[model samples]
Target: MLVNTFLPLPEFITGNILWLAKKGFAITLFLIGTDLSLKVIKTVGIKSVLFGVILWAFISILSFIVITVF
Candidate 1:
């Protein structure tokens, strides 16, 4: 969304923002993934996990379709 909404700007500023955002995303994923355990997964249940994956897949496909069509 931010990428789609950003206005035209100087190349250096845009490059910095893109670099920082990528780093932030990597750190966030690392933090979230580090805490995973069998107990947590079992507590959440297989059904819930599978449902979330399916939902994510559907949204990803939809996004791809819309982006391509437009």
Candidate 2:
């Protein structure tokens, strides 16, 4: 939606947005990789792994709700 606000933006800023979009994918991938690595490090056994996964899912959902609401 924010991206849509910039329809017909001046060329320079438009280019910047395109560049940011490209870089954003890389950033997201890196973050996901780091998160998985941390989970691997913290895993103890099957029970702990399940709890960690559930906790991560809950946190992710909460974050999504907060971002969308705000």
Q: Pick the candidate with the highest lDDT.
A: 1
Q: Which residue window of length 10 is worst by lDDT in model 2?
A: 36-45
lDDT tens digits by residue: candidate 2, 1-70: 3765866667788788789988998867965876655556556566776786799899999999999999
lDDT score of model 2? 0.76
Q: Clash pairs of candidate 2?
A: none
Error of 2 at 56 (Å): 0.2
- TM-score for each of the candidates: 0.50, 0.40
Off by over 4 Å in 2: 1-43
Angstrom error of the Cα, residue 64, model 2: value is 0.1
> CA lDDT, every prediction?
0.81, 0.76
lDDT of candidate 1 over 17-49, digit per residue (tens): 889989999867854876745687799898987
